[model samples]
Target: MGELVERVDERDRVLGVVDRAEAERRRWMHRIATTICRDPIGRILVLRRAEQHARFPGHYDVMVGGAVNVGESYEDAAARELAEELGADVPVRFMFKFLCLDGVGPVWFGVHEAVISQPLVPDASEIAWNAWLTELELREVVDRWPFVPGGREALRRYLVSGNEPARPRSAERSPRPAAMPPG
Candidate 1:
């Protein structure tokens, strides 16, 4: 997670800018992150971030997520994160990318998803708790808790787009956009 940050536009698309200059010049250089959503008992898997994390500690996140490396693709990062954080081995499908232009701080939240193939055993070091949330329950949680701050917006966009996760595929590459570079 060395510096080499990324820059993006309002759509979270790469803006071909460097993170160091963005910060030194007071510009937004997005930090690439891979977000994963899962079907936990036919509901979305929700995880509470560990209190030890540097940002948004102890808050609720949709599922597995982490920063992207300087040269890694978002899909690979998401897939690795799923296994590293939850001991999951299912295929990771691509979702949409989220740009927090409002933060004036560049932190590109690259999103992905994978269906649950087996029971998840989330790593206690990275996550604190887990829950399965129906759409209604998700709405309530989004409305009530500050899940990712603009998480409600992200969820809404994801729901409206109807982007479904791809089943396990060992060879086929997902059409999902790649943002972060895998380590």
Candidate 2:
């Protein structure tokens, strides 16, 4: 079955729903949700997208997430994505949402964070590999490893918040106005 995606306007108001292919073909804005998972010791979880996947195949991503289906809330999507990709159902707290420019159109990206207490079992179909890295470790290899642009931006935002797993209320409620370069 084709995926039904929630379509939105420039300001992120819902316009209607469309199939994923049509949404991509028309460059329609749509919703996506991601979660930055951290181990109890504070190491962040990172994963590489499967090489066989479409869109930045084989690239590293800092979070586990995917497109929000029609009628699904971002928070629900975040949890669903975490479970689907990593087989971990950690309690994720919503961080923020921003309009990110992508190859097709602007994506209403909702980010969340959680400290995981259980071991993650990666789904091989979606993830090629996974790792838990400290802030310094991530910094050391980030420049050399190719990361998905939007995930990189989200990681940067996480770091800017003083390495906090969750975003501050002020920043989460109000993201910057400009379109973030997917770097």
Candidate 3:
């Protein structure tokens, strides 16, 4: 699920879409679009990849996500991911945008807030584990868990704004509990 596809932004101007492969391969300007999804208790959504995943296998990831499909709008992709990964149809609210050079490529991610947080049904082949955490706790875990390198800052801006993101905190749930496991 290397859905790190992004737009070729010429400083915030829509140039064109580039495939994740080309962007990563050529170090082109690109961004991994994602959504800051929340749970019923105001907890943010997190996901874990199955052991069989080719990349970042067995790592914990938080975000209702996927690649921005060709010809798809960011909001549409976010809404689609909410339903596909969380098993809920969420109406996306446009928030902010994060600009970061993911090292491999530049990401202009469109941050959006879902209207509601609902139970998830992650794609078995993609999500290994999933959970919800307070914004404070999200920062703490980023320090302890193997999160995507650029996720912390983006998560911070998207969730708590300028406030430091929660990291290196204990998890309220086990890595894989009775909850649904990433297939």
Candidate 4:
């Protein structure tokens, strides 16, 4: 038996719990909670997936995340994934979610962002290598790198929105964009 994940519908309503493998095999919609981390100077943290990873092995990814466990809120899953993968216990702000049409199957991708102030201890099972790249550097290499397909789509949507995570005590409040309509 593998990890249990919530099977979701097109509107992201939970249908039932299913094994992660079963969900993938059936092409069932599910939820993935992802976080984009940035340094204080605004460089995005990017990492290469470990070669042993089951999905997109050795590919670069700007988003750090995984499947949302059954009954977990997107926010909680985002924070949990950040701590597990990067060892950063930071607060993450929910940005937006979209139905990712690309990749192995459709999933409601909950996107979040965090500014990491603590040192990172990358998990060997998940990250092979990591680096902080300026937005310009990331944009330049995004096309050339063998990036994960779903992550690439997330990044595209994020960049287009031009919204940054709110810093503590910042008065600026960006309006949340409506969820992307299912294609």
Q: Which model is ahead, 2 or 3, in terms of lDDT?
A: 2
| lDDT of each candidate versus the true structure | 0.63, 0.80, 0.63, 0.84
Candidate 1 residue-wise lDDT, 82-144, digit = tens: 889988888876777766544334456677767785888889888887766555556566655
Which residue runs of candidate 3 sit more than 4 Å off their true CA positions? 1-7, 115-117, 162-183
List the candidates' TM-scores in order: 0.72, 0.85, 0.74, 0.88
Model 2 segments beyond 4 Å from truth? Answer: 166-183
Ranking, TM-score, top scorer first = 4, 2, 3, 1
- Which candidate number has the best TM-score? 4
Please write out the lDDT profile of model 2 over residues 111-137, one tens digit for every residue: 999889887789888998877766666
Model 4 scores a C-alpha lDDT of 0.84
Candidate 3 local lDDT, 1-183, one digit each (tens): 454454566575556666677666776766445677765555677677678875567777665565667667778888887777667786887677767665344666666777464446777877767766665656567767777655656676665564223332454533433243334
Task: Return whichever of 2 and 4 wins on TM-score.
Answer: 4
lDDT of model 3, residue 123: 78
Worst lDDT run of 10 residues, candidate 3, spans 162-171
When sorted by lDDT, best at the front, the candidate numbers are 4, 2, 3, 1
lDDT pick, better of 3 and 4: 4
